[model samples]
Every structure is written in C-alpha cells, then in structure tokens.
Target: MARWEEIENEAPEFAARVRSLFEAGTNKTIATLRKDGSPRISAIEAQFEDGEITFGMMQDSLKLRDLRRDPRLAMHCPTLEPPKENPESGPGDAKLAGLAVEVPAPPDTPHVGAGFFRVDIREVALTYVGTPADHLVIESWHTETGYRRKTRA
Candidate 1:
C-alpha cells in the first residue's frame, strides 16, 4: 500500500489523469464493508491535501462506523456519459481500491467532530473507450504489479 504521493512519483501522468477525474465532480461514491461483510455504498467528498487523499464523515455516521470496523474500501470518481457520436472524446471514469487509515484532524479543522481517513492505495484504474471507439480500454496501476493497460472488444 502506498500514499497518493507515491503514485504521483511512480506514474505521474496516470496519477494526474486519475486526480483530474476525481476533481471534476463534487460527489464521489465509496464502498465499505458492513458488519455482515456486505458492501455499503455511500456518497462522499474527498480532498487531495498534503500529499494524501482524505475524506471525512459526519460524527457517528454509519459509514464512519463501517470504516472503523473494516478499513478496506473502494472509491469511484463521478461517472460521465460518453458521447455516442464521439465516445473517444469522453473523460472516462476512474476507480481506486485501498485501505483507509484513520487520521487526526487539524486544530482548525472544519470537520470538528467527525472521522477522517487517508487512503493507502492498493490499486488504481481508469476505463474508457479506445480512440477509434471500437474497443474498451482499461489502464491500471497496482502496488505489486505497477502499471498496465488492457483493451477489449
């Protein structure tokens, strides 16, 4: 697992593209594990600060509870509909999977009494239509395997 900064250092262009996708929208989706080991999907807003990707939840929120119980999580950037006439023009979609490590809030933090966490990324991926719009393309980076790209019909 590595911090967001590590990804930037290792794969600058890929990291930039992924970060742009995340920043393009205000709300993102996160999946956490429930007590029964089921997946819980929730809306969230994350920030890139101090070389980390962090998010905060309201105090005592179920999502916070879920994170406390199980730190594993996956996050998806806001999805954009690809242009039917020119699918290659779309910005595409990005996703990341990682472990959420709890962090201390700063003294003047806005989240006063909330839970905060930083992602220790396991893998990151971006999916989109290929240039000719004839196939789907997936670009991914993993902690152990590094970066790779795949295309499918």
Candidate 2:
C-alpha cells in the first residue's frame, strides 16, 4: 500500500452514489485461480459498509478454499438492471482494493463464508461519456478504513 501522503481524492457525489448503489444490490464477481491454474468464478451478493464490502457464504465452499492459497484477488461489483445482467455501465471511478482478512465461520449459520471482507479502497477511476465527446476523466483515492477523501489537496 502507498503512503497516505500521495493519494487522489474523489468527489463527494461520486462516493455517495457508490455507497448508495452498493447498499441496494450489486453483483460481485470474485475471480480466483485453482491449484492447476484453472479459473474459479463465483457470483455473490455483497453488502457495503463505510469501510468495506462484506460477502457471506459457506465455509466449505470452493471460493474460500481458493482464497486460502492465493491472497491476490480481484473482485468486480457491477450495477445492473432488474434482470441483473449487463451492468448499467456507470462511471468506472469505483474505489477498489485487495482484501486479506476473512472472518471465521458464523455459529448459527454454520457457514464458513458467513463473514465480512474489507477493501481498503486505494483509488477510483471515473469515465464520463456523453453524446458529443468524452471529456471528464478523474482518478481519486480514499483512506483505507473509511471512504474518506485522501486526495483533498
């Protein structure tokens, strides 16, 4: 992770939209590699908090097992229409980060994946497209813990 001193800041409205949309329901595509170099994919429901987005699932599931070996992971939370296919394709300025800590299995649920994963959003890229021509493009960063602006300068 880079030092706090050097980071880009995101606009308030952008952050707010992310927070709101995530709350409703976004398809999270978690990509991981298998032992034989095969690809493993899982689509899951993700919830976003002030600091991180959480995913709950079974402990004995395939995804959790894959995560144990390869910590390096990439996840895409896409916002789509009711069908939940073909994401709306909004601004790419989404705060993203790699997650490490995976919570222990939940007692009642008895699910191995019934826990939360935190993403310390390092930065986001915003792409603006309109009728005439693409004009606005911005990259910003935020504090790892909460969605606080790190590029406010």
Candidate 3:
C-alpha cells in the first residue's frame, strides 16, 4: 500500500490540491442513524490531514451519544449536485477533481480506513455527458470508512 506521506509529499501538485481542497473548508454534512434507528444529521467542518479525514463533535451533541452506541457515520460532498448545470458556473471546478486521478481503476483508493467516524465518504462516481456548451460534467469523490479526530494520527 502507498503511504500517505509518499502520495501527498512525493507529488507536490497532488499534495497542493489535496491541501487546498481540505483547506477550502467546504461544508461537511454528516448523517448518522441513532440507536433508536432515527436519523441524525449536522453540518460541520471536515479536513483531510496526516492520513485521514477529521471532524469535531460536541459533547452534548446527539451525534456524540449516537456514536457511542453506533460508531458508523457518513459524509457527503458533491462536485456538481444538480443534474443540469448552467453554462455559467462558479469560480472554479474545485480543482479537487484534478487530484482525483490518484485512482486508476474504479474504487482506486483501497486503503480507506475508519478515519472519520465523525464522518465517512462511502463512494465516488464521475460522469461527463452532454452538449458542448451546456454539457454536464460530474466528478464525485467519496470514501466508505470513518473515524474520530482524537484517535487518528
């Protein structure tokens, strides 16, 4: 398996983009099921560092209680949420898409761990199909496992 430092440190361009994406501090909405089987969701800050994703949960938050009973969690981030997008987009493509090349074949990233129990990115899919001007291009990034901040290095 490729070490986190090897991938992030050896490839400066890739490293730069990863840092930027995580640093962008895009809203991380985490949804987890409670012990009673109810749904719990919240918006918080998520970051990729060292070798995993990190998130903070307050002591009094219901999320914290749920985790104690059921540690599983999920995180969601969309490069292009809308099925149909306008020609005039935003400032950039998040640039994060470029770095997604870290994967060669499908499910390219195999070593994903429970690094974000605070949140998890379970799957990723990409699509680029449409007209020339108003074409729809979608590149999704995701992971399955999750972990907590304090426990991860």
Alpha-carbon runs more than 4 Å astray in model 3? 1-22, 78-121, 125-153
Candidates' C-alpha lDDT = 0.93, 0.50, 0.44
Cα shift from native, residue 51, model 2 (Å): 2.8
Order the candidates by TM-score, highest first.
Answer: 1, 2, 3
Error of 2 at 105 (Å): 3.7
TM-score of candidate 1 relative to the true fold: 0.96
* lDDT tens readout by residue for model 1, 86-130: 999999999999999998986787776799899999999999899
Better of 1 and 3 by lDDT: 1
lDDT of 2 by residue, 45-95 (tens): 666543455666555777767767764455555643322242234433343
RMSD of each candidate?
A: 1.0, 6.9, 13.3
Better of 1 and 2 by lDDT: 1
Best by lDDT: 1
Alpha carbon deviation, residue 94, candidate 2 (Å): 3.7
Clash-forming residue pairs, model 3? 114-146, 114-147, 115-147, 116-146, 116-147, 117-146, 117-147, 121-143, 122-143
Instruction: For model 3, give the 10-residue run with minimal summed lDDT.
Output: 96-105
Model 1 / residue 78 / CA error / Å = 0.9
In the range 23-142, model 3's lDDT, one tens digit per residue, is 655775566678889878777566665564555555457766666666665544434433446433332233221111111222553433312232232332223343443454554333
